[model samples]
Target: MAVFFDAIGQGGSDGHPFYDSQRTEHKHVANGGDIAVLAGISYSVTDLALGPWIIWDSTLGDLTRKVSYGGVDMQPIGVIQWGGTAPGAVDAWTEVFALAGVPAGEAQVVAAVWGGMNSQRALRCQTVSYTGVHSIGTPIIASGVGNSAVTATATATAAGRIVGVFGTRSGMSGYNGSQRFLSNDGVGLLMGDAPGTGSPQGQTVTRQNDGPWAGLVVPLQAADTVATCEPLIVEPTISSRVHRAPRTGGLRRKVFKVPADFQ
Candidate 1:
């Protein structure tokens, strides 16, 4: 949605009415004059109309007022003047606050600014509050794991099953390159490997009764498959004393067969 920053003269002028500028119960600048306005996702406001003022985004359900603009007395609307150091430029700026009927009690300042020419340029405000947080989702075990404490075992005591892992950390590439250790006995752990130090060591894990198993498993390969293939026996053909089936055909046929013992 496009947000408008166009300003109309609040005085007598032949300008169209801005119905959506403020709340429905509140009155907008009627019979306002035409003034140059800027609007966009990356637009900046001045101290005059920006400071101590109530700013609104498309998603805001209620009007939010700012407590102070650049540490000055709070006002519903703020005005700023830039280029004070520069000749013939107004460098002073003010911020206006928007109050939700109640004054000085539990009011939220949606926006604010510090005093100075580079105040808006400071870009110190937090954008996360407006954007909201997002989850990366849980990670899946790529391999089975066994107790790392044993160190002697080559693989898990039993066929290890993957439980869960993290896809990313803090919205960034999560521990992707880092070595991960996990135990089914609630001993899953991740560690960062530092240079000059021996390989990263697994931290002790305390398994909870309701947590994963005590033994952890990780895949040596990208995916898991059956351990071994069974052999098939063949009898001699009509002319040959003994004949063996074709490796490909024999394995395919043997694998395709349904067990007679299966109900």
Candidate 2:
């Protein structure tokens, strides 16, 4: 029977490709392994991609890239890849979030943290064509810029559902000092693969690699490169304690502690 079904393997001995091809796809404790980033890269930034964007940690204090020339707004930590030479590396590791090797170079800050539902089937694209088109990016409009450019006509990437929305401080309010705030609700691209929205303070998400922390992360700056961390993340250790991610992605791996008389 076809050599006993290729000796019980798939397309065996070393040709395995019968279908699905199986591929890949975290940390922060907020994304996996621990998660923390802060060193350099963030002024006009340079090269980075993976999921979610905009992370002000407080800028200068670290985690700078957006808020434009100053950084104050917040949201995004779900980069999951990039940081090969060190720009903060948001990489979640799955072949360096694809593009391969030393994460193929790129990443600086954005390892996702703030928390709540993500993963979107590893950011599938399938060429693009989101069926019913309730939004095409993520229904209900997340906000940033793109508003359109998601093109490609058909192949199917899943087409979203519970997409994110809330920027320009959708709830508004800021002030922490050495940077590092929190707030809430940011990442999206949820059900049926719906909606779309980039950055403009509206919510920011789209440098297009699929949108929403899938790309447009930017930071990379370990002088030039290597040691890119990945095991999920956890190489700095600032943790005053906030880590909360895991509705589908991860983080919130646990580390509360703050009531020692309210610190």
For residues 99-155, write the lDDT of model 1, one tens digit per residue: 111211121222332221222221111100000101111111121122122110112
For residues 47-75, write the lDDT of model 2, one tens digit per residue. Answer: 12322463312211232222100111222
Error of 2 at 125 (Å): 16
User: Per-candidate TM vs. native?
Assistant: 0.14, 0.15
Question: Residue 7 lDDT in model 2?
Answer: 7
In model 1, the worst 10-residue window by lDDT is 124-133
In lDDT terms, how accurate is model 2? 0.20
In TM-score terms, candidate 1 sits at 0.14
Task: For residue 254, give model 1's deviation from the true position in Å.
Answer: 99
**Count of steric clashes across candidates, in order:** 45, 61
Q: Candidate 2 — which residues are off by over 4 angstroms?
A: 1-57, 64-146, 151-185, 189-263
Off by over 4 Å in 1: 1-76, 84-92, 98-104, 112-120, 123-263
